[model samples]
Target: MLSAILLFGWDFAMRTYFPEDETPANMASREDAPSARADGAIDVGNGSAGIDAPQVVDVDTALASADRIIIDAPEILGSINPVGGRVDDIDLKTHRQTVEEDSGPIRLMSPAGTPGQHFAQFGWVGEGVALPGADTPWQVIAGDQLAQETPVTLGWDNGQGLSFALRFAIDEHYMLTVSQAVRNTGTGSVALRPYAFINRTSANASKSTWNVHSGPIAASGEGVNFDWDYDEVLEEGPVELGNGTDWVGFTDIYWLSALITQEGQGASGAFRSTGGETYRADLIYDPINVGAGQTVTRTTRLFAGAKESAVLSEYANQGVENFNLAIDWGWFRLIAWPMWQVLIFLFGLLGNFGLAIIGLTLIIRLLLFPIAQKQFHSMAQMRAVQPKMKALQERYKEDKPQLQQEMAKLYKEEKVNPLAGCLPIFIQIPIFFALYKVLLLAIEMRHEPFFGWLRDLSAPDPATILNLFGLLPFDPPGFLAIGVLAVLLGFTMWLQFKLNPAAMDPMQQQIFMIMPWVLMFVMAPFAAGLLLYWISNNVLTLAQQKYLYMRNPQLRMQMEKDREEKLRAAEREKADKAQE
Candidate 1:
């Protein structure tokens, strides 16, 4: 119930304050989005809202039939459309769609008219002059293909002596440099403002939730901003990103597509909602006056690729302000960043993500070993004194203050701190949250295999008991999908609890007894790696409990006595009930 409330609160907060969380079914085409108006005013939005939709076709047909430039780089592979000159078709070479070996590479961008139409285009927006639209057939005059060492230059002529060119260059990773230029050779001077916009439908975007932000994200001159959600953009209309806007774009859990304006250009932008369930990020520069035979050029970089941590950071260090912040680390970034580094180091050393996770657990356990030892010894001491404590409690049943005082004295005499066991749990809260964020956001962990039947550690355990681990024909509902690791987690936790001293309150003891199974059901749908960690921790705890028992014979003896007495009392009660 508390978790539900927190989630609701988070959603409410994002909707109320930042409100950019929305998506629609159809989108107004780029041709409909005239960058400027005839009244000598700049709108940077759709002129004729929701008109001239593209023909719906499969991505393969669209790419095969169109005049496009192939993108062949170290990490990226895609084709650039020539008609609109949009970098739309992109797929990661190394990342696959699923754990299956035959699964295809992960696609990052798709062309317009497709079900997942997402693309970035650079062109001119001017009044009283001809400009390139989505239908402008651009000719590649410089290079046949886009490679790390080779760049492609696309040119277009308005037939009125105005020549336009878009130079495209790519790095080894994901950044693409698009330089937009306009040359005036007609008899008269022309005023033109260069603009770039990323248009997409929300139909295929990742679900936006309270904690993990999806949709419009930005890095202003001040810092990285995640406040503008989709709903706000739809309700409030186009959001004007004032001057000092460094970069702006859409972000998913593992993907990002943004436009970074040139440094010191003071380039401004806005996120506009075209009539359909589509949106656009427009990066606009001031209008430049080009005299006859003169030219104007503006350079902007488009980043459309995976949000890899190391890659993002490297870009950030090279002057793309707060680029790494694209990977939402939450408020616990201080702890999470270091933890991520350690995890990466372990993965490098172990060569398997599952083994790396186990190694991380071992390291954490070793670090907290001393505290846990103290906790167990303290618990044992407290248990050894329980009989005396209970006797005093009964004597002072009507006087609670007196009971607490005597309890404190008894605890002091026994050298046991009542709160010792709680310290380790409190210490683990930050570590647990850090791991949760890291695993959920890291694309590198996706499709990583652990062991038998655990092909994807980032996903829930696929083998569930309800279906006999795939022996049966039916699949279980989420809550009932108890997997092998979950079962082991429950048993190991229950065993560890059974070794501990019994709670004085019957209700508390019953809760402790049931908690393991409850957690097992609750956690069955979470990532297998998280479950593996808990299971490993529980097993270590049981071993620690056993070792501690040997070191404290009195505590072990009392536990045995308590168990036998409880069993004998249960038998007597059963016999009495039978007689009655």
Candidate 2:
């Protein structure tokens, strides 16, 4: 862990400390665009930074006819990629950040940053009328525009060994497009292969960044991970723990790549992420003759939209690494996606939002019900045979060997399985972890509604103002609602502990009792969505156990008989084997 931290620290330091060249004198300041300040700075109205739509550039002008153009401007808004901020409430408050002109690479104002900050890119609009060309079959025309309905054409330079130009544009709906024109200007033909890269950095420059916190725990044999390659494939490495830079990467041609290769010359490709972010890079790298000054041009499109597998599949099929649902961090795919999908599916099936949560809880209970029943049945059998076992213990109290022998005989006769209970919970451990991750990362629950007072299921219940006595502790009247939810969580947890006493051993009980307080401290700042899931799950489990207990008082007795039958069958099988 220490070593991982050090490595991550070293990587961050290099990125943060690496000196960037000054902005070119000829280049127009981003603030020069309409609604920008004359001095090239963002105007904060009334001490608040209002979100301003990004400046759209003429595609033809930005990707003007040029030879070997290197667009190294640190902060070119539309030129950078797109991102969705915070998905997990226990983690960080998600929002976009303010743009600083000094930021070398265009910064994505995601969670932990300011709010409403965005860069337009490719978008999806279900099977309806899209933003004009959205549904239109895209070609290498790679035309760009500064505003709605205006089109601009871009060209490449002649005579240069390698000539490439990039154009930035936003369609009517503000989706981002970065079209490139790459050409091998030399006499000999060569492939102008394209690759995309991504990295993480702090937006605030004044403050020294100690570390960037990310993650819940990791599974065994897996290391702390992050996307290194723009491809978004999660590869395992050494366990990286602590506050520092962690990176993961994958090649584009791998699974989920949307590249359409044909006759060694591919044109117009799109890359889609399963996390709902997509980037399209078109290739026009056709062979050219130097003497005649011929060149090939390529253009690309990027979409920062939904992570629905179907959506991604659509883009991937178009020959770009689009629709990849792989979790860029940890075992999110293996754990998070399935869990959230289950919750979402349940919520949709149930008409009432709050009842949907109840339904989800019931489903989980039913799935685990068989295992829990088996465990409880075994425990009952063990307790039933205790009287006989106690007699043997007393009779052989002086003869230790005889007591042990008698105990074994009693176990065989009564047919009690001591490990039945332990096995069930153990089997559910992976599922528990998967659910935990889903609650942390699923965006489907974001701003979702759960009915009455809980207007937004994705957020915590807002405090309701009532003059309930100063007894609520916080002098503020609104705090009364917060206190109520906290109490409800506590009561439910306590009741669960009381009813399922066997579920807690000495250590487990201590941990359970202590964890709520710790959770309170942690959840106070978390999104209310997570708290709701936990509360609902607990309540549902409590109700299910109570129902089972009431419905079948002799359930344990039946289990004991079943155990005896199994034991007798095993003995008969052993005898048959010996005779053979």
Candidate 3:
């Protein structure tokens, strides 16, 4: 019955309270029918071609082969490939590849032709106007290097009447503002549409988990966000978002790459998984008509790098519609956002994330103190009536319905709820999932350290009892990676169970005894921060139970009676052995 209650409560919280957002109406309507060209090719609207088959090359060769313009900023370091005029080679200076301080910076984008080639490409595509393709070699017109203070401009001119120029400006952080302009230096008026696309040769290394979104996500200003898996994008062909303030990009566990546009701009966006391990998130603005001797320019923003909540929120606050939605806060944003804020506050107060988690658990316990007190008082009443309940059970052994009616009547008279014990677990279910989402999606928690042997709180505990906590030379299997924290979690759970009122049925008693150890094994693979939270929660609960039990005379009396009965049984067994 307890297991059923727990499972049902968890399911209810996940399905009802934290439901996945339905695919945006625009996306849903276009899912079955995508636009196609007259030639029977999948028209990825905006003049974007089908996903190109990637040519694999070594990273060193790809970097060395490209004639590049360097990009140097405080937060980002990369270069632009002139061959395609793609901002492709980027490394996030603020983030490392691993937890070690000496670890290399995280490589965010690699140039094309590499094994893990990924890049952002911006260009003009139009009919009868010979625009630059992937093979066009752009000439650096203005700045030699791209920086926060200095913007770089790359220009290319077709033998026809049109000349295109791209001016790139980057902030200190991750956002890049690219402005595309065209000059009709010929006799005839020319029409061209500006388009920006992020292309990747392979999916991210981090596997998409149920809790964290790690693939294509789009948000139309209609207050709805569409999240899709890479496989879904591949199987469903292409996802198109019609005119609105929308952003389309790929989100990994910690990093994000998105194309941003202005509000009410009639731009079209599409996400397509090209064959041979390639995926593209492309956006194209409406065509601009430039008369002879006239110039037209359009601007858009590109966001690439770590998905810092504050940075995303700042962008959202600065008129980027729903930019904060980039961080997958899930459906329970109301609860999860405040919870995350409090956690961040606690982390600021306390330097260590482990301590912050413990602080958060204490705050939750204090907040729910009144409800827990009532629950414990009702439990005490139930414990006091256990003897009467057993007598009633014996009296109505054959009449199950009558026994249930009598028990209900007894509970009413005693002012006790039989299911009141489930209140805490029910209250905790949402919090548990919220914290899980925060730990899984928050970049601040990535590679954040706790005390000894706990290097990365967001990652599973590395030390294992089976390997003597790394003292042994050989490595232990994943299931056997039970660390000290996991053991403490089980111990605290067991302690809380011991403090609770004894179950009436032997089977329930047995289950209660084994449930903690079972959960410890089950949670062995979870993040260390999550295990720390659970352990702290269990300990606090055990403490609360002990304090409540000590203050309640009825509970104290029941515990004393059970203790005396156990002692008497032990004495009787010894006496019987002596007589034998």
Candidate 4:
């Protein structure tokens, strides 16, 4: 057990310190890509990153130029590539590339020849069967537009009596249900394995930090495996984990493109490199034998869009196991999930994500209010017994354990819970961290407008003071990018610290005086919504402190007494220095 723990710790530390760089520093040449399959389809190993494909136009130009079927869903907008029936071109209609009015919709998946090459492909591989290849331009037989209300079907037929059709259906959100049906009209039994995979260029992926997983991610019956990132594929070539693969795909920080396997179907998934910084997440099922005139249909769900917490959770609730974890809520998800629900509810009520965050803070404060009361009461009791505690400490100065024991005895006798004052802070730490993770990971917080000059709460504050609130053209670096929210945060934190009694230790007092400003500088680069949350929390803390002080007169008196002593001690030290 000890060795396991130590091994895990060492692995974690290595990953944390030396996170794999998503950049293709050791990328193989495009010419070295795996050969095309016997069926003329891009080898499943060299999936759809299109390493050998020629360069094409820009994203918009590429989509406009392609002979494609339109995808006009509520939140997703793209085209289905008729060639190979690849769902290659996608843009999030609800999300934008930037906050600018003309920034345009976020380009989620672009054509293979384009820079943002990301897409999902579904087909079959079989022995003694003629399968549809990449060059096969599937004919649109049913629907004109692939919309939520209108489902589209693309079909192709091999000369050898094998008929293949891909029926595509979409919901109001990002889930695309792909039904791949193969009808064996021949005389003999046809054996083929149905498979789907998402392929993308690692160059376009969001940076995969050790904490927030990007690159290849998948979920099985056990749980989601966040271990294999693009770096592993870029370095190690092909990698496969334990089987029972439920879903497999590539995930960015805000976006994801996963192929969820059919329920109860035994499937194997793996990540592989197709050379030139391209990676693929393959979901392959066991081969099934279809006798003459038998049609085999496989349904694969493609999730390609923003990783909104609520949407992911909804999918998870509907039986997509661990789908909610796509957002990487981390260890604090117990608090984060409920907090996210409350935040969503508040947003619906308040009509602003930023306001909803403030509302959530208020709710957290309310939930911790009882603890706050107990904390103040404990502090008051401790204050009333301070002199007695000091006398006991002096008497047992040389006996450390005895001093702690006596202190516990004194607390019991005085009906004081000495540790109670710390309980609130301990509780708040996880809550605060949970909120931080929410702000960082939730796509719902992306591009949300807060108030004046505060657009895109997920981004750092734009009205940076160093640039004179965007009045001046001067752009400062990250260290100097103090914004209005950061200023308020520092000021509010200082006020909160000042509300407490002054520390007796000079160094500790100095640290308290400097800590707020230091934290302000450190936190300036965080999301504006997070800064807003901390500022709101600090303001509430000040109010709570005032009310608690009023409720505990003895505590207030103790605070005053401590302040006076600190002042007198400073003056006496100054006099001694002057005499010297």
Candidate 5:
């Protein structure tokens, strides 16, 4: 019931606060059709907006069919498709599809006709002016190849006295600057609105996790940030933001492509999913009127590459307008961000992410040492009063209230809080989740190798015991994929439980004994780095327990006495059963 209420409340909050525009089906009849008006102003309705529907074809066919210009930046390789002059194909030269050095580069964008058709396009929507369309084959007049030092310029003329020139400049990294210059050479003035869009025809192929966002995300210069899933965009139509310096784009687990502009330079943009596989994130500027023989230019930037933390921070620092918010830090940003920074620092020192995780765990344990000591002392006190507690339980077995009253009185008299042992666990929960977020979201952990049998700390341990660590022929499924680290984690957990004070109830004792193994299976699918941290924590806790037990001699004596009595009782019962 509580879960249902929380879910309902969350739904209500989303609908009320983050309300989206009407669906495309509902708006189709109300809005103008997606085409140019008689005055040459493009009627870019919410859905199916700005341009004609793309034809379905393979990526190779699309690239082969277009007259393409090569893009040869230091970190990126792609082409400028003359068919609409779109920055269609892009591959990150630094990142590979696989860990192998010989693997292909990571492809970020593809031609419009591909299976995963995705591309970034820039053009103009104008009134009584001729603008480039999807079929317009732009003429490359400047450079043959786009590079860091050399820029590429594409030109087109409407023959009615309006000429358009697009100049593209790229940096050594992944930022692209597109400057659009419109010259009015006609007898009359023409009005044009510069626009940029990122279009994706298919959903992301990467596995989507609930915590990791993989869809449309936007941020404004005014500090507003919003994100939506693909289905939400489809159901809610378009998300309209008022004019401000803003950027909107799509983000997968690792890559991002956003269109950015300065403050108050353009009209507020919209992130729209056209009620199908087609999705577009676009920014349209206010109309610019240019008189005859006058030229107007507008510039926008594009960020398309891996979402690295330092790189994103640099861009954000360089006035990119909340660009660092692109990486989904979730609700735990306060904890997760610092944790990530610490991990990066430790990794730089240790040269291994696994070692860095171990280092982080050690630091956290040290910080929580005082609280843990209190919990351990309280547990020892509980152990010392175990006999008295059992006596009270037997005396008040039939009276539940009386038993609770007696327990409370006994706790008060002994100065022991029964809930003290839970404090450490409560504290560890947030740290555990924060570290999980760091491992899952930070790109630094991707493809990082640990010690033997742990090639990827971000992924689950691959070597399964069921396959005898790859010696056996048959492979095991996910449930049966318990590896060496998982087994060690279970063993350490069992040791930690055994070393601590035993529970008073038989059912509780049984549960404590069974939980470690159950969690071994449950945590088998978690990252190996997480399992390593858990194991390290358990070991530290076990050591702490030993020290506490040594210091509390009375508690140790009581536990030993209880153990001896249980053993004697068992032997006596055995002898009696044999005689009978």
Candidate 6:
């Protein structure tokens, strides 16, 4: 009952807050989709909102002054409106160096009913879809058409003389390509440092209120580690944004991310998106160094993909390393993962889960048959001696020690072992645990239904509904499935107890009566697939036990005869030895 309440509460909470998948027509119905400012930032909760300004760097001055650009925003887009300028102190040898983009923060304004927004920046992982700019500013002069305004010489030091050509180009995919051409300009060898930087505007108060979600990935090799983090964000607050560490998580949602860095490698960095109306960013960097007079170059890609799994998969294939599974609990994945592959292989040939479970159970029973047979025979021997044992106990009533000794002697004489009958249960426990694990985690069963009312193999059977006074939330289905199986279990226990008649132990009787209900309650939350398997096993066990009992009714007699033959052999051997 408590479990049912918890499940219901969880469902209620999800529906009340999070936006479900919506279509464009219904989007207007949802009054909750917040708007973004000319500057990137979301206004949430309050009517009025504001954020910090972008750090303006004069790229021409930066090149002339040998200064670096601090990439502050989590995401940025090339200015749709370009600015024209020239590099200071450097003559334009029919050349130019400018920082420009078609847009800055890649804003996603979808037509879907569930309004959504994202910014393009560096993904948590450094290798996938990435943002332009590192920590250093580039020489700039924005124009309608792509052109180089200045050429700067790059080297390890001022005089060492290994130089590279730095060129920028705007490509078809909203891409800004930065290329470097290496040249050995001096007698001495030199290596150059390559880096980039980015900055973004903060989100408005309403936008800040949007929730934030991220996915993480980590890789460790050769004592070096890298952590890739990516997720969705929606919240209500002053959004502090940057491509840096030390950011608080978005609220009201579950998150899964990976963090990778080499063990013992001290690397510290942060990606901050301080504030943006619809902030999203993906960053990629290949921190490769140019060898002495030997130039090596690298490139990165950026993407603006939807949060859907299939869309994410496409971007991921395009080098977005932090690909996350969109559906937290996928409809079919859980049932398909782990053992589902194996199950499918077998089911293809055998064609039934029921048959598979039975076959598996039969194999287990056969494996335990030796121990089980011994136990059953022992119980049978004990049952056969019950009459004599009862008589001895009554006759020796007041002589407790004698009664016990005689009972032990009688058990030995009859070759009975009390614990033998418990072997089946002992064997069944491990099989139960193993089968339960397989069913619980196997994704293949998620929506795979058994016939009638058991539509989802991975979920609890939902066909049962009790509307009267809210008694049981779900009524169990099919007498043969639940009721009949339970009855068979009870009958089997009763028969076993009858065959091994105990001496009126009140505690034992009470335990026997209470156990079945306890087991039923324990199994209530499990998937119907698992429950059905257990029920079938119980039914089969009952049938097998009945068959064994009827076919070998004098099992105890045979055991006693074997014991007598051994005793007679020992006596004859003793007499022969004496005569000799």
Runs in model 5 lying further than 4 Å from the true structure: 1-58, 65-67, 221-227, 274-276, 576-580
Stretches of candidate 2 off by over 4 Å are 1-152, 156-179, 182-201, 204-293, 299-310, 317-323, 326-336, 350-355, 389-409, 452-486, 501-527, 551-580
Output the better candidate (3/5) by TM-score: 3
Task: Compose the digit string of candidate 5's lDDT tens values, residues 446-483.
Answer: 88889888988888998899999999999786666888
What tens-digit string does per-residue lDDT give for candidate 4 at 474-578?
Answer: 888666788999999999999998988665467899888988887887788889999999999999989999998998888898999898887998999999999
How does candidate 3 fare on TM-score? 0.89
Show the lowest summed lDDT stretch of 10 residues, model 3: 24-33
TM-score of each: 0.89, 0.51, 0.89, 0.88, 0.88, 0.43
Segments in model 4 whose C-alpha atoms lie over 4 Å from true places: 1-45, 48-57, 64-66, 392-409, 576-580
Q: Write the per-residue lDDT of candidate 2 for residues 1-580, one digit (tens) a residue.
A: 3433554465567667985544321111111111224663221111011212232233334223332112121111232211111110010112122122332331332211122112222211111111111112222234332333433333333334554444545443212344444555456544333322111111121121112112111111133222232222222322222221111122111111111222233322222221111111222222233232455443444333323343444544654332333333244356555555667677678754456656666677788888877776776676567668768877999999988878888888888776775876686566555554554444444445665556555455554234252334454422123434454666677776555533214578677666554444334333455566567767876776677666556654444555676699899999999999
Would you list the C-alpha lDDT of every candidate in the order shown? 0.83, 0.39, 0.79, 0.83, 0.79, 0.39
Best by lDDT: 1
Residue 337 of model 5: what lDDT?
94
Pull out the clashing pairs in model 4. none
Q: Of the candidates numbered 3 and 4, which has the greater lDDT value?
A: 4
lDDT of 6 by residue, 1-580 (tens): 4544554565566777874533321111111212233473322111111111222233233233323221111121222110111111112111111212322332321211112211221111112212122111223332233422322222221233543334444322222344444445455443232322122222211121112213221211221112223222223322233323211112111211112121222222223333322222222232343445565553322222122334334544753343433222223345323233455556566776645665666666667767766776776777678679879989999999999999888878887776777877876765566566556544334445567655555555554333222255655432212332334344545554444334336689766665554455445456667777766666556666666766667863554565676689899999999999
Q: What are the per-residue Cα lDDT tens digits for candidate 1 across 322-430?
A: 9999999998899889888888999999898888888888888889989988887887777878779879988999999989999888888888788998999998888
- Model 3 clash count equals 0
